[model samples]
Target: MTTTTPTPPAPTPPAPAPPRRGRALDSASSFLRRRPRLRLGLLLSAPMLWLGLAYLGALAALFATAFWHTDSFTGQVVREWTLENFRTLFTDEVYRTITLRTIGIAALVTLIDAVLAFPMAFVMAKFCSPRAQRILVIAVMTPLWASYLVKAYSWRVMLSGNGVIDWLLAPFGLDSPGYGLLATVLTLSYLWLPYMILPIYAGLERLPASLLDAAGDLGARPWRAFRSVVLPLTFPAIVAGSIFTFSLSLGDYISVRIVGGANQMLGNVVYDNIGAANNLPFAATVATVPVVIMLGYLAAVRRTGALDNL
Candidate 1:
């Protein structure tokens, strides 16, 4: 009887349900997964389009405007191509002097920033604990959070007679270097020092401590080791920082206006033409000077692989 009861077979289980087709989004994601290059291209397309339309388009318009001079009688832009602006920029002694002065200031600022930044960056990267390094980084960047005008005006006050600098130097019988070229340089150096410091800090952080120790073991003095090893390694980072400091100084007008007394840079010339003189063509022409100089500087830097560091 038991065997007969067992003879009744168990009911078959219900068949498992088939998976439904994926949604449109899932399908697209699967497709993209198979074509990584296409996915990357899609991601970059929007930014590239915006850059082309906004930045490159504006630069093109500026370059075009530079060729067209203003009608003196009408004070209106005349849409005609001419090189009179270039001719004047080259031939006029005032413009030439301004150009040279601008270059010299930019160069001096770069040199000063390099000299000051290297040691601070080395200390930050090699000596400090990680927490201290972060605190120092925040300290360096804190000034950038303040308004540009605020910083400039603060410097203006400090550079004024009997200001903080004068007070500090009073015991030494020294006066504040009043507003002028020196003030301009000092202000610009302060403004751009962070830009210089961060890059060199990054470079130094990437440097290996063993190299210094190895050099020491090889009977190299600190100065010799630094000149032969550290300097060469960090040179590209310095150049990368120089790009920021140099270009910013070259095109700076606000800082100059605040602290640069009667002295003028190429930026001042450009600002004067557009605002006071109402000469857009000449202003655009003046704008090209920095652009061209940067292009040349970049070309040279490209050779040294400094651009890669940036």
Candidate 2:
């Protein structure tokens, strides 16, 4: 009887409840996994929207503003569309000279940077050990971390009479090429050198050492190998670097103001129109010059397949 009274059967345990968030997450992950294109689109949507709104929107606004004009007496922007700004930009002698000067300086900066950066980048990519390469890269990038104004002002100081450049050249019959077009060119070259180096360095890094070796084995001299094998491959990268240097120089006004002395560039014109002259439409029109130049430059380089590297 006592045995029959049998201990009450243990109550069956209740089944555990499934976690809601975990199920949702797992389902989402599976859904995303099944549609990789959707996943990718989702990932890029935010950035693309930002770029479209911020960059392209601003550019559109600028172009729109360029067509309008300002009232000279009232000093208020007139929303009416007209080609007067374009006419002024195209017809004015001062604007033409400034445009030419801007283009010339940008070209010179691009050239100088290419010449200087190539050898340095070549040495870094082909010759240096990994640790040394890292150190050299740091050295190259250190200047970039400094304030742009600081670097510009530093050059200003060095280019001043009795400053570093003058001091260095005093022993010789030469003198510092003081603040002007020459100074502008030098400062721009220095400032944009890193932009050129980084691209060439990245390009050269991808170049096969085997190709260089093969050229040498086939009786190509060092210079010949470089010209035939290296230069052609690296040319796209040089063009890419030139784009950065050229566009940046084209739009730069601050460095010119700091070290350009009496000289002015297109950027100065835009700056003066916007600030001193209070002419927004004219400034937008002036700003379009560089944008047009860059577009043409990009179109020219597109044939070279340089855009692929970017």
Candidate 3:
């Protein structure tokens, strides 16, 4: 009894008071909770600023430059707004030929990639185990680690006369196209195939196994199940991949220079006008062709649900 009286209940432990900083934090959180729209606006402000200032601003400047004329005698930007650039772009035979060539190659590359990627993506998504799928993905992305120029230069060497293509195909009496439009298509298809494969693979991966089972249970054959269920779901992914491949191929000038031989695409024309001819206005005008084409392509694809899928 004497010992119990001496303890004095340890001074009641100060009632375990809450931290002041924690109270401030709680008040801040409550403030944000009370103003949800303000919170969302604050969150979005940075990215909106970036998009408006950097991306849209650059595009506006580029299109503005397209309207300005270059002084031929002075070799300077005139800053005079005129439609003469568009007139020349549309009226010139060389520009038309190059535009068509660029479009053709881009289309061919996209088609080739789609054909090659489908079976591979289907096998990876539908057939492979999880670990194997991961390994395959790493393998697919591995080549992208190499410098684009390095790969282009490697292809340049391989496609040269008496290079690897020649050495390998000598026994079969076949030959590589050897530095031309065909060579450009081949290199581009190889480079961009992984881009196509990944999207379609993701789309296929998202397909439900139960859906396939249900289709089979309903008396649908493999082909029928694929046609009725799988293809429709995955078509968006194909279009998504095509958008990337097609747009990238449209503006590419380096690969064209390396493997395109004497052939010039729209990109080469733009590059020449800018660097060789010192014509920024005309270059901007030429540049608008691909931009317009891509815009038109996007408009066409918007109805396919692909944009929403992506």
For 63-124, candidate 3 gives per-residue lDDT tens digits of 99999987778887988889999998888898888888899999999999999999999999
Poorly placed runs, candidate 1 (over 4 Å) = 1-22
Residue runs of model 2 more than 4 Å from their true location after superposition: 1-18, 21-41
Q: Between prediction 2 and prediction 3, which has the larger TM-score?
A: 2
Residue 191 displacement in candidate 2 (angstroms) = 0.4
Give one digit per residue, the lDDT tens place, for model 2 in 199-292: 8998999999999999999999999999999999999999999999999999999999999998999999999999999999999999999999
Off by over 4 Å in 3: 1-33, 214-225
Worst 10 residues of 1 by lDDT: 14-23
* TM-score to true structure, per model: 0.89, 0.88, 0.86
lDDT leaderboard ranking: 2, 1, 3
Screening candidate 2 with a backbone cut-off below 3 angstroms (N, C-alpha, C), the clashing residue pairs are none
Per-candidate total of colliding backbone pairs? 0, 0, 0
Pairwise TM-score winner, candidates 1 and 3: 1
Which residue pairs in candidate 3 collide?
Answer: none
